[model samples]
Target chain A: MKYKYWRRSRVIPFTLLLSNLVYVSFGLDPAASAPLVADTAFTKSAFYDQNEQCFRCHGNSKYTYFNPVSEKDVSATMCENRVIHRNEFYTANHRSFACVDCHAAEYDTFPHPGQLRMEAPYNCIDCHGYDEQYAQYHFEEIEEEFQQSTHYTANGDAFTCWKCHNPHTYRINIRNSTSMQQSIAYDNQICLNCHSDFERFQLLSDREEINLIQKHEWLPNQGLHFSQVRCIECHARLNDSLMVAHRIMPKDKSVKRCVECHSQNSLLMSSLYKFQAKESRSDAGFLNSIILNDAFVIGANRNIILNRISLIVFFASLGLMLMHLLLRMIFKRND
Target chain B: MTEKVYHYPLWIRLWHVFNALLCLVLIVTGISMQFSEPNRSLVPFDLAVSIHNSAAILLIINYLYFLIVNRLSGNRMHYKITEKGYVKMLITQFRYYTLGIFRGEKTPFPVSEVRKFNPLQQFAYIVILYWFFPLIIITGLGLFFPEMIITRIFGISGLFLTDLFHILSGFVVSMFMIVHIYFCTMGTRLTSLFKGMINGWVEIH
Candidate 1:
C-alpha cells in the first residue's frame, strides 16, 4: 500500500514537469499559455486571505521538487518546512504584516501577470531602500548595517537578509530572560543553516569549511558558550551600538582568549548584558555598571568594599611592621 | 670565639634560593597584571599572565619539595608550639625582639640542630606554610578552573570571593618577605645566616 502511494505521488510531479518541458521546447509560455492551469491554484480577490491561500499549495505534503537557485534542487521536505507553519506568523513579531506587503501587490489577480516570476517575490532592498531622514526606521538602518556586514563583503551581491531571516516567520525584541536564550539560539540557528551545512555553504561561497569544535577547542564548555552567546559577539567588530556588529571577522581575528570575557571590563557586558537601559553606563561608580547588573561574572564582578578594605589593611599592616623594625634598629644603635 | 654548626641542608638551600627568585617574579608580574588594560599595562598583559602562571606552578613544586623534606627529616617538630605556656613563649619572644636584643640579653629560645626557630618565628612560619599558602593555591586553582563543579556548588559569587582571598593572602606574604629579609640580616654577624643559607653552616655567638 505504501509503495503504491509513493509511486502515484512520484508520477504526478514528473508528468507536470514533462508538460512544462514540452511547452518550453516549442518556445511558448508553459503556464502562461494555459490560463486554466494557474486558475485552479489562486482565487482572484481584491484582498488576500494570507493564511489559507498561500498555505493551500505550500502546506501540501507532496514530493514537489524545484531548482530555486542555479542547478541545486531543493526537496519537498525543505519547502514544507519553510512555508507550512502558518501559526508561526501569527506569533511572530511581524504578525500584523499582510502577505501582499512583501509578496506581489496584487497576487490574487486571476492569471498572474506574464512578467511576474515565482522566485524573488520581492527583494529585501525593494522594501528596505535607504532613507536618510528616517534612518532609525526598521528597514533603512538595518540595510546600512547589512551593507557593512561580513556576509555582504564576502559574497558581495550574493548575500541577502533572507539568508538569515525568513520573512514569513522571523521575530524580534524577545526580552523575557528565559525566552531570550531561546531567541538567541533561534537567531544563531539561522547562521548555522548555511554554516553547519557544508554542501549548502559550498554552493554559495568558496570559503574554507569551518570546524566549530576545533576552532573553539581552547575554550572549556564550548557548547555552552555557543548556545549562550551569539556568534557575532566574537566574530563581528564591536560598534557603539549595543547590538552585535554586522562586520564579521575571520576566526583568527576573533577574540578567543579566556581573559577577554573574564576581565574587569568584559565586552560581553556591553553587548549581551546591556539588556536594561541603566546598565549601559561605562562608569557608574563602584565595580562599574556592568557587574552591578543581575548577572555575576567570575573575575569581572569584583567587590569594591572588599578591594578597598583589603588595601587599607595591607598598607596598615605593612606600615606597622616597618615602624616596629625601624624603632628596634634605632634603639639598638642608641644602646 | 663563635662555634659553627651545620644548619640548612643542601636541598633546603637550593629550594630557598629558587623560591626567593620565583616569589620575586610572581610579585612583580602579579602587580602588573592586576592593573593591566589594552591601552595601559606595565608589561604586556599576555606576557605577564604567562610569567605569573608559570612561576606559580614552579612555586607549587618548590613548596611541595619543602613539605617532603620537612616530613622526611622530622623538621616539622621545630614549628610545633606546645599548648602549655604558648602565650608566655610568644610574650618572651616579643620582649626579646623589642628590648632584650638591643640590650644584648639572651634569647628565650635559640636556633639549634633540634630547635630550628624561636617561638615567634615558628608561629609565623606555621601561619604562612599551613594557612596562607594553601589558601592562595586553592584560589589559584579556582581561577584556572572557573567552570568546575565547585563553582556550581558555591554559586556565582563564590569565585570572586576566592580571588579576593588569593589577593589578600599574597599581600600578607609580600609583607612577610620584607620582614623576613630584615631578620635574615639580624643574625650574630650580618652575613652569618646569609653565609649559612649558601654553605649550610651558621656561626653562633
Candidate 2:
C-alpha cells in the first residue's frame, strides 16, 4: 500500500507540470475560438501577424451587396479594381490584415447583403487594450454620449457607427439616404444625440421662469418646433456663425424669458406660462405639426439689432477721429 | 521702344487690372468674414456681400469679354495648344523661371502679338481663367442664394451639403492664394507682377 501511494504521488506532480505547459503553449484557445464562423486556417496562414493582412479576405467581400447606384457600382466584384475608400484607413498608419484580426465575425456568403456577425463596438476592448498611442481616442465618451442620447437612450445597443456612418467610405455624404434627409432637416441629429431631449422641456410656470428671451419668431405648427427653438431660434448667428443665447447664461429664469424671442408659439406662451409646466412633447404632441417654409417674421423683427449696434460703434469711432483732428488743428495753430 | 510692343488691347488691360483689384478686395473682406465677428460685424456684411456679388458679376462678364474680344480679333490663336509648340513652350518657360531668371539670363520666349505669354504664363492664365474663376463664381452665387439652390435643385434637404461645398470652394481658393503669392516672387523682378497688375505693363529686360 505504501508503494502504491508513492507511485500515485509521483504521477500527480508530473500531470500538474504537463497541464501548466498546455496552458502556456495555447493561451486558452485565443487562436481557436469555437462557435465563430471564420476558418481558423486563414489565421494560421501567418498573414495576420500585422493588421494589413486582415483585409485580404475581408475586403474581398466588401462591395458584394446589390448596389443600385447606377453611376458607381459598389458590388464586391468591382471592389478588386476600384480603389478602397481612402478614409477607411485614414489613420497615419493602417494595417492590411486577415478578417479575423479585429472583426472575428463569421462571414456569411449565401445571404444577399452578407451580414457580418461580429462582436459589439464596446467589445473591441478585448484584444485592443487601452492603447497609449490612441489615448486621445475618446471612444468611450462618444459611446456613452450616443447611448444617453434620446434617439437611442433606452434602446442603445441597436446601433453603432455602422448604422449612420459607413466605415468603408467614412464620409457623411448627405447626397444619399432618402430617409436620413428628413431627420437632418427636422433636428440636428448629430447634436440631439447628446443634448437633453428638446421635446422633453416642459414650459415654465410663468414667462418669468424662462431665460434668454430675444425676439419671438413664430415657426410653423402653432410655434411647437422644439427642435428649431432649442437650436436655431435662441442660438441664432448671422452668416452661419456660432453664438449662445440660452442655458449658457447664469441659470436665473427671471434673467430672460425662453419664449420672448423664440416666439413660434408666443400667443400660447402666455397660457402655457401660467401653467408653469415643463415643455413635454408627449403632453401635447404639437411638435410634429411644425410647417415648413413659413416666413421667419417674428418678434419686433430686430434681427439686425446686432448689426445696427456695430454700425453705431463704427460711426462713433469715425466721429472721434474727426474730433481729434479738429482738436489737433486748434492746438497746432495756437502753438 | 514705347510704341505699344504687341497687340494687348486697352479693354483687356483694363479688365485684367480691374479683376486683380477686385480679387484683392474680395480676399481681404473674406478674411474679415472668417475671423472677425459672430453677429456684430464691423465690416458691413451686407456691403461686403454686395461688393463680392458685383465683383463676381464683373469677373464673369470679363471672362466672356476675354473670349469674345480675343476670338473676334483672331487673337485666340495665341492661346491654342498647338501640337508642335505645346511641350517645347512649357519646358522653355519652366527652365526660365527656375534657372534662367535667377542667373540674370534673358527670357527665352520674347513677347509678340501672336504669343504674348511664355508657356508657363499661358498655362497658369488658362487654369486661372477657366477653372478657378468659374468655381469661385458658381460657389459665390450658390452661397448668396442658398434658398434658391436647395429648393429648386435637390429639395431643401441638400442645404448643409450645399453649404459644405461652398465652404470647400473657399478653402481651395485660400490654398491657391498661398501658392500664387509664393510663385509670384519668382518673377523676373520680385515685384514685377505686382507692378504689372497695377500699371498693365510688364517691363522686358
Candidate 3:
C-alpha cells in the first residue's frame, strides 16, 4: 500500500510538468509577450520624435488659431498661420513620414525657430522623379495630360496633383461591386469642390457664370443621369488607358448624340463596364459589354448579326406571302 | 350538303383561346423589348419584362394542360401520321393549298373524328409543338438564370445564344401565326371554322 501511494505521487509531478510544457508550446501566455511586439512595431527615432513635437503645436486645436483676433495672444496661439487638425494629420496618407522630410526645419530645438516660415513647400516631382513606377496604372500618362488640362493652363504651378488627390488623405482604389459608382462620385467631388463653389470659381476663373444644372439643360432628367454616369465619359476623349482624361473641351466636343452611348461601340463598354468584357465579348456572344451592363438599354446592347438576320427573315417572309397571294389570284382568274 | 359533326371539345376550345391570347402577349412584348432604344421604348423595360415573364409562365401551364388533356382524351393521335403513304398524303395536302384550292377542288383529307388534322398540318404541328416550343422555352429559362447556368456557351456568352435563339424561334412562330390565321379563311365560309370553334361542331360536306 505504501509503494502504490509512492508511484501515484511520482506520476502526478510528471503529468503536471507535461501539461505545463503543452500549455507553453500552445502560446498560453499572450499577455507576457505583447509588450515586446508593441516596442518593436512602434520604435521611436530622433526624427520621429521631432515630427511628434511639431504636430504638438500645429496639430493641436487648442494651440492653433484660424482667425486673426485669436492670433493676437501669442500664448494662446502656438501655430499663428496654419492649423493642421490632429486627427487629419494622423489619418493623412503621409502620416508615416517625418515633417523634416518635406520641410527644412530645425529638429533639435523645442520651440521651432522663426526661420521655418521661409522654407518652400515640398514639390511632388522630388520623390516621384521616375515615371516607370506608375506603369501598372499608367499614372504617368495622367501626369502628362494634367499639364495640358484647363486647370494647368489657367492656374499653372498653382494647381498640383495634391490639390485633387490630397496625399494627406488619399488611399488605394476600393474594389467592390459599387466601386465604379463610388470612384465616379469621388472624382466629381473634386471638380465640384471648386466649380460649384461660387466664391472659389469666381476667384479662380475669368468666367463668373457657373451653374452645372444650366450647363446640362439639354439632358432629360439631368440630375438622375449625372448621379448614374461619370462626367468624364463625355467631357474627355475616350481612350484605352485607365487614367481619366484631363483635356477638358467645349460643349460642342462633348458626347451629344443618343446613338453615341446607345451603340455597341459605346465608351461605357470599355471603361465603366469593363468588368463585363470577359463574359460578354465572346465571338459567338450576342451582346457587347454595355448591353450586358446592369440595365438593358435597347439599341445599345443589340447584336449586329441578330439584327441583320431578323430583318432578312422578316422581309423574306413578307415577300414569300406576297408572291403566293399573287399566284393564287392569277390562278383564280384563269379558272 | 353537309352534316353537323362534333369537332372541338369545350376544354380544347378553352385551351386554344387562352394559348392564342398568351402567344399574342408574348410576341408583342418580346418584339417591343427587342426593338427597345433610349428614345423609343414602346413599353417601359421593367413592365415589358414583367409582362413577358408572366405570359411565359401562363403559356407553359397552358401547354401542360394541352399535353395532359390530349393524352387523356387520346386526341394526340391527330398530330401523328401513319408511315404508309404519309409522304404521298402530305403532297396531296400541299397540292390542295398551292393549286387545287384555286380551282375549288375538294380537300384530299377532310376533317373527321379520328383524323382531326390533314397530313401537312400534322407534320407542321409536330415540328412547331415538339421542336420550336421546347427551344423557345429552354432559351427563355436560360435567360432567366443567366448568371449561374447561361453565362458561357459554345465559346460565347450563353445569354447571347439564348437571346438569338429566342428571337429567331419567336419570328418563325410569328410567321406560323400569320399563315395559320390566313388558312382559317380557306374554309367553306370565312366564318364557318370560327363558328365550329365556338360551338364545338363543324358542318362537314
Candidate 4:
C-alpha cells in the first residue's frame, strides 16, 4: 500500500509539470489566450523578463553597434530611433504589455537583420479594430476620422497617428489631468510640434510657414485664448461620442464666430469643458457653471433669475415715465 | 421779463454733450450684447464690442474731467445734500413733479447761482454719479482685466458677481438718462433746458 501511494504522488506532480511545459511551448496558457484588454493584470515576472531583454540594448543611452570590419561592437551615442525611456515606457497605457506582443519575434535576435528594420510598423487598427474588448475606444471610428482629416487628405498615407501621438508615452490627458491648463498645454503641444516647427511642417507640406500670431490676430485676446483653450476646440469637427475630436477642419471651415464659445449654449461645454461639465451637471441652476470656476464668458454665464428681474425693472421704469407724460397731457387739456 | 443765469460753463456744456453721446452708445450696444441672439443681433457683435469699448474709454476720460473740475470749482457744492431738512426738500420736489407741476404751481427750488440744481436733482445726481458711476466703472475695468479680478468671493465666482453688478448699475443709469431728458422739458419751454445747455445760460421767469 505504501509503495503504491508513493508512485501515485510522483506521477501526479510529473504530469502537472509536463502540462505547464506544454502550455509555455505552444502559447496555449488559458490566461495568455485571453483578450489583452486595457488594465489587464499581466504576469509580472514574465512580463518584466520579456521587456528587459529588449530594453538591455534599447534603453541604454550609449548603446553599441556591431562593427563587422573592426570585428568588435563599437559604442554609439543613442539616437531617437533606438532609445526608449524606461520610466515613460513603464508608466504608459501599454505598461502591462510584453515587447514581443506588438513586435515580431525576429527582433529578439542580437545585431538584428537589416530586413527587420524594413518590416511594416503595426497600425492602431491592426490589433484594436473589430475586437469587442476594444470597441468602446472606437479605434475604427478614429481611423475613419483620420482618413477624412486635413492631415490625411493633404499628405495621404504619410500622416500616421504616431506623428502626433507617440504610442510609447501617450496617455489620456484631458480626462486624467489635474488642471485644465495642463491638459490644454499637453494637447496643444502635439499640434504645435508639427504646426509651429518649420522643419517638421515642411515634411508634411511645402506651403509657406504660418505666423500663428498674425493668423489668429482676429481673435480677441489672442494670448489668453491660446493658453486657456486647445487648438482643436475651434478647429476640429465635434463628435459627441469621442472624448477628443480628431477630424481637423481646414482653416476656412473652422469656427470664426465669437458666439460659438460666448453664448448660453457654448460649444466649449461639449468640447474643452466636457469632463468638468459632466462632473458639475448637478448644479444646473446657472448656465455654464463649469466654466465659472475658470472663466466668465459674457452672454454664456447668465443667471435666469437675474435676467428676468432686470427686464422687469427696465420696462417698469419706462412705464412710469410714460404714465407721468399722459397725466400731464390730460391735465393740460382740462385746463 | 426773464433773467439769464450763467449756470453752465463752456467746459461743463462740452462735458454734458460728450457724456450724453457716449452713454447713449454704451446703452444700445450693451443691451444688444446682453439680450440679442447671435444671428439676429441689434448691433453686429464685433462692431458692437468695438463701439462699446471706444465709448467706454471716452466716458472714463469725460468722467475724470468732471471730477477734476468739480473739485477745483464750486460745482461740487451743487451735488452735496448738507441741508438739515433735505429729505423734506426732496419730498417737496417729488410732489411738485407728480402733482403741483400739472397744477401750474411754481417750483419750490428753482435754478440759482447758489443752487444750480433742485434738491431732487441733487440727490439723483449724487446717487448716479457718486454711487452707480463708480460701481460700473470699477466693475467694467475688472471685466477688462479679468486676471486682476479676485477668483472667488463667498465660494462664488468673482467675475460673475462683478458682471452682475455692472449690469445692475448700467440699468439704473439707463433709467436715469431717460428721466433726465424728460425732466429737462419741465423748464419754461420744451427746448429751454436744451438751449440753456448749448448756450451756457438758463432763462429764469
**In terms of lDDT, which candidate is strongest?**
4
Error in Å for residue A255 of model 1:
5.4
Clashing pairs in 4: none
- Residue A27 in model 1: lDDT: 21
TM-score of 2: 0.37
Best by DockQ: 4
Candidate 3, residue A28: the lDDT equals: 43
DockQ of each: 0.16, 0.01, 0.12, 0.43
lDDT of 2 by residue, B92-179 (tens): 8888655564455677876554556777777776676667667767766655554455433343324334433544455455545545
The model with the greater DockQ, 1 or 3, is 1
Instruction: State candidate 3's DockQ.
Output: 0.12
- Give the total clashing residue pairs for model 1: 0
All candidates' lDDT scores?
0.64, 0.43, 0.64, 0.78
Model 4: per-residue Cα lDDT over B84-193, one tens digit each: 99999999999999899889788999877677888999899999999999999999888777677787798766878898899889988998998899889878777899
lDDT of 4 by residue, A105-223 (tens): 67788767788676555566654566565566688898899888998999887888888877666655675555677779889998999889999999889899999989998887676
Candidate 4: count the clashes. 0
- Of the two candidates 1 and 2, the one with more favorable lDDT, higher being better, is 1
Scanning candidate 2 chain A in windows of ten residues, the lowest lDDT window is: A238-247
Q: Which residue pairs collide in model 1, if any? A: none
Fnat for model 2?
0.00
For candidate 1, write residues A1-335 as lDDT tens digits: 22332243335543343344333222245433323223223433222365456555454564344455666745444344545455555434334444544455454653347564533434444433453322333455466677777778778767877677776566543232334456568768878888998987896888799887786776654665776577877887776653445666766678765556556777776666655433255543346444433334434555676667767876887686677668767876887
Q: For residue B185, what is the lDDT in candidate 4?
A: 80
Which pairs in model 3 have colliding backbones?
Answer: A92-A168, A93-A168, A262-A300
